[model samples]
Target: MATGKYISYLRVSTSRQGASGLGLEAQRTNIDNYLNGGQWTLLKEYVEIESGKKDDRPKLQEALQLCKATGATLLIAKLDRLSRDAHFLIGLQKSGANFVAVDMPTANELTIGIMALVAQEERRAISRRTIDALAAAKARGVKLGNPDNLTIAGAERGRIAGVKSIKSKADVFAKDCIERIIPLRAEGLSLHAIARVLSKEGILTARGKAVWTACAVKNVIERIEGL
Candidate 1:
């Protein structure tokens, strides 16, 4: 068996599957079975515990990033491990990832097109079933539709916190430069003029670099404003 770099992706649809590790183990076994004495390098393995209802899986995104950065192909034990939706399959195909689904070895372009049609029909069937269920519930005076926050508020908070942290760091860097470096330069000195002055005076940046740039000066000023 000949192989290059590959990234393995595994997902379990429910907490039960995740807790038992049934889905992940089975998928791993399948991948191992396929690799069977092959010259393949498993670059990374990404596991996610999430419903197949959506595609915004964190581990999946990480796997894709690794694949893209390393020029590796993505390997999944089964197609349904990604999603049952055909549009999702099409989107994956369009994402520039070379995919190998163990269960769908025969899923060429033709099979994929046919599956897309079948998926559309399945969506229609699901819609019809929902309408029928809604009618039955209305007959019994039952209400539905639960509303909740979809976006992770804590994740947004973390982002805000990170921005604040960076701003603080940048401000400190700028303040030190302005208080010590700028005034010396404002005395009729250019960037090169400042560099020569600093070097002759045996002064150096925090990085111990003697060279100076106009951009560095500007960056310090911007950071002071951030402070």
Candidate 2:
């Protein structure tokens, strides 16, 4: 039932994956299979080599713009390749452009919302499992922490360094989320609607809550714009 001009967007998480065709070929094959009997015109294909965690994707922006301007449907091999972030996906849903993931041709906003929640829970479970595993290892008389056998002061320094590293990564992620939020706001979505979209996408706040409020969304925007 897909009938229109189509713009394809493909993404690989790493440059190595892009170069070595680790996940690219499978995506291409899926797209091809989806388009086999469809009355669709393939406009252009854009490939992006970037982490899904970051939203500063130039190629993806271009593909979406093209779809908007040309009334073309944006096609991707998989939902995750398009984005793992719910906010980004929600923004796209509201952008007045059509998109179809070959892997989930029947997917709609509701299904995407469910998928995002599941994915978020899976990530949290993985982190918990890792922590539990480490605790169990320590209980088995394994000497954990400070593999180099540092002094107390050295251990404090290491802890400080680790906090800084985590902060740095968090800042980068915040900036990326802000980038997506700004565009959505500019597109005339109210803060509440934006928050709803983000929540539906299972995006977490700084405090790791899966739900968002208009005030929370506004605070993030203001903080990021101030920076």
Candidate 3:
């Protein structure tokens, strides 16, 4: 249940939808139900009548500013109601305002940031690995122009297998670390406290660092939970 102050942001793809209270009313109801049982206060609500593809949302910026100023949450009915751009969501975390989507209320800036990092790292790692494999295959005399060559197809398969192998290793490590951290979290330890405990107990981060940050702990927690 929500228990703090919140500023709601509602969006409609067209002016007619806004005028008729079609999408807006449903979003408002969702927010109301989310806040129904909590000692929560809805400070203000901002409406935006624009295409989702448009990024220059003046009302969203205003709501964010208010959320930052008042230390209240930027509440929304659904994540899609906000921009689906990864960079936009990352920038929202940097705006120093907390936000919660009714559809994924358990998520927060910390978790969002962790998720972004994992996605970014996965993309970069796989890209680099695939590129490296191509370079290696070329060095081993696999002609790029010969699509008819069985060796070329074999190299392509090898590249895909390498990508999967690397990802599987990363996943296994995260799963192992998260398994250990779960009981500490269940015991009500703060994230920072858990990090300290991990460090003091000689636990290493997913990247093999001897120390752990609160963000790292959050990343690991979300990693295994997501799986």
True-structure RMSD, every candidate: 16.2, 14.4, 18.2
TM-score of 3: 0.47
Q: Which TM-score value belongs to model 1?
A: 0.54
Error of 1 at 24 (Å): 1.2
Can you tell me which runs of candidate 1 are displaced by over 4 Å?
A: 80-83, 136-227
Give the number of the best model, judged by lDDT.
3
TM-score for each model: 0.54, 0.50, 0.47
Tens digits of per-residue lDDT for model 2, 54-167: 667777788989999998988878786454565456556666678888887887767666766665676678789999999999999998776664788888888999999876
lDDT of 3 by residue, 1-227 (tens): 67989999877775445433457678888988888897888998887666754557677889999998998988877675453444456656677787888877888877677765765566578779999999999999997774543587878887899999877766676766776688998999999999998877545565545578999988877777787
1 or 3, greater by lDDT: 3
List the lowest-lDDT window of 10 residues for candidate 1. 201-210
Model 2: residues with Cα > 4 Å off, grouped in runs: 80-83, 117-227
* Candidate 1 CA-lDDT value: 0.66
What would the TM-score be for candidate 2 when compared with the true structure? 0.50
Instruction: Pull out the clashing pairs in model 3.
Output: none
Q: Rank the models by TM-score, top first.
A: 1, 2, 3
